[model samples]
Target: MGPLIWIIDEEWLDYEDEIRVLEQAFPSCAIKKSGYDYRGDLDKFGYLADAIISQIYVKLDAGAISKLEKCKVISVYGGGYDRVDVLSANKRGIAIAFVPGYCTDDIADYVMSCILRANKPIDSYGSALNDRIWGLPAAGKLRHRIQGSRLFIIGLGRIGRTAAAKAKALKMEVSAYDPYVNEEAMDSMGVRKYDSLEEGLGEADYVSVHARLTSETEGMIGIEQLSRMKPDALLINTARGKIVREKDLVEAVTNHIISGAIVDVVAVEPPSFDEPIFHCPGIAVTPHVSYLSVESFKELKTRTAENVVKVLRGEELKDIASV
Candidate 1:
C-alpha cells in the first residue's frame, strides 16, 4: 500500500482547487481530509499518517505529538508555526516545514496600508460623507504627513525589512529595534538601529511589530512598553497577538495612551464577544489574514505538499522549521 497522507482541517479543504494540485503531486499516496472538529483528538487519526498537513489554528501540542507514531513530516499551512510544539516534534525526529517568504510581500503591503491610513483622513471623511454630513468637520484634526514622519519597526525579519523599505520610499524616516539583526544590516537598508525598544518607540510617529512569538516576545509590548510610545503614535501589529497583552492594549487605547492601533491579530482568534478592543474607538481589528494574497496563497499550498513528498523520498526539505 502507498503512504497515507492526511490533509487535516476543513480550512485547507476549502481550497478545493489547491487540493487538486496536491492530489496530482502525490498520485500514489492516499490523501484524506477532516473537518475543524478533528482538533485535540488528532491522535486518533494521526497514528496512521505517514505525513500530515495542518491548518494554522490546529495546535500540535506535546500530547498530540506523542501520538503520531508513524508521521514523518508536518507541513504548516502558513508562515508562523507558533501553534506547533516544535520541541516535541524535534525530539521525535519529525520534520516540521513552513512556507515563509511567500507572505513577505503580502504582509508588507498590509502594514503599509495601515501606515498610509495613519496619515490620512480617508476613513473618517468617507464615513461623514456617507452619512450626508456636508461641511467636512471631520477634517479639522491635523493629520500627520507621511513624508518626514518617523516610523519604528520591532523585529527586522522578512516582513519588517520589507516594511522599512516601503516606508523609506514614502520619504519617512525609518528606524528599527531587533536584537537578532545587526546594526550593519539596518544601516545598509537605510534604517536607523535603536539599541533598545524603548528608545525606538519614544521617537516614532508610528510603530509596527513583526517579531516572532517566543518566550522573549510573548507580551513583549505590555503597559511599560506601550507607555513609552508617543501619545499620538499609531501602532500596527500584523504579527502574533500574544506578542502584545490584550488587556494592556485595551487599557492603552481606552485611556488614549497611544492614539490608536491597527491590529490584524488578537490574543485569541475570533475573540470573545466581549473583547474590549473591539469596543475601543480608536482600534481596527482584522481576522488574522494579513499574510494573504492570491499569489501567496497558491505558493503556500503548493509548497506544503511538495515538502511532504520531499521528506517521504528522503530529499532535503526547504524552509525547515527552526525547531
Candidate 2:
C-alpha cells in the first residue's frame, strides 16, 4: 500500500494543533509534508507508502497533480476548493474532502463590519483616521441610519444566508440574488429575493458578495454590472476575488462610481498601486483575512485534521461538494 499521506498547504505553517492531531492519529503511518522537506528526509528514511491531504486553496496545476502518482485523496483545510481542479482530481480518482464551516461566522462578521463602516459617517465611525492624509479625509463625513435601508446579497449559501440574517437583525431590508435558491426557503429567512443581478443592484443601498469562484462566476462583477448600482451604494466582497474583475473595481472606485467599497480579496493578492486599485481613496482593502478569526481558526484546524484522518482511512467524508 502507498504511504499514509502528503500534506501540502499554508495551513501546515498555521495549524500546529492540526499537525499534532494528525501525528497522533497516524503514528505508524508514513507521511510527507510540503513545508517540512519530507522529500529530503525520504533519502534517509526511504520512501514510505503514499497518501496525501492538502489544505484548501493550495496550488492546483497540471504540474502539481503530476507529482502525485500515489495520491488517493486530498483533504482541503477550508472551504472553496477552486484552487484544486476538481475535474482533474475526479478523473484521476482522487477524492477531495473539504471543511465547510471554518470561516462561516468570521466572514459574515467581516462583511457586515465593512458594510457598516461604509454606511457610517466617516468623521464619527472612527476607521477613517488612518493618518495617511493626516486626517483630512476625516473632515468628510459619511451619514447613515441603516435600519430602513436595503442590503442585497449576491449568493445565498451558508455565508450569504448568515450575512442576510445579520442585516435583518440590524433592521436593514435584505434581498438576495441567486436563481438556484429555493424561493420558499429563502422567504422564511425574511430576505427578499431578486432573480437577476441588475434587480439586486437597482434596489440595494448596500451589496455584499458571498458567491463561489467557478467558471460561471469569474469576472461576473465588472464595469458593466457595477454601473447598475445606486450612485451612493456600497459594494463589499468577502467572496473570492475573480468574482469581480480587479481592474474594473479600481476604475469604479477611482472614478467614484460607487459611494464606497471594501474588498477582503482582489483578483490578484497584494495588488500593485500601478494597477489603479491601490491609489483609490474611500476604499478599504484587507489581506484575505475576512475568513480568519481565532475562534474560527481553531475550528478550522480541528476539522482539517479530522478530514485528513478520514481520507487516510478511506472513511466517508463531509462537505464533498460537486465531486
CA RMSD for every model? 2.0, 4.0
Quickly count the clashes in candidate 2. 8
Best prediction by lDDT = 1
lDDT of 2: 0.74
**Residue 272 lDDT in candidate 1:** 82
Per-residue lDDT of model 2, residues 1-323, tens digit only? 23456666543455577667777886765555664233443333323325456655455655455555656666676787877777777776667678886788789999888777666544453444555554556656545678999999999999999888888899999999998897898899998888889878988888999888888889999998888888888899988888988778778877778876888877764446365555678677787789887788888778767776776677888667564
TM-score of 1: 0.94
Instruction: List lDDT for all candidates, in order.
Output: 0.85, 0.74
The clash tally of candidate 1 reads: 0
TM-scores for the candidates: 0.94, 0.86
Task: Report the Cα lDDT for residue 175, model 1.
Answer: 97
The worst-scoring run of ten residues by lDDT in candidate 1 lies at 10-19
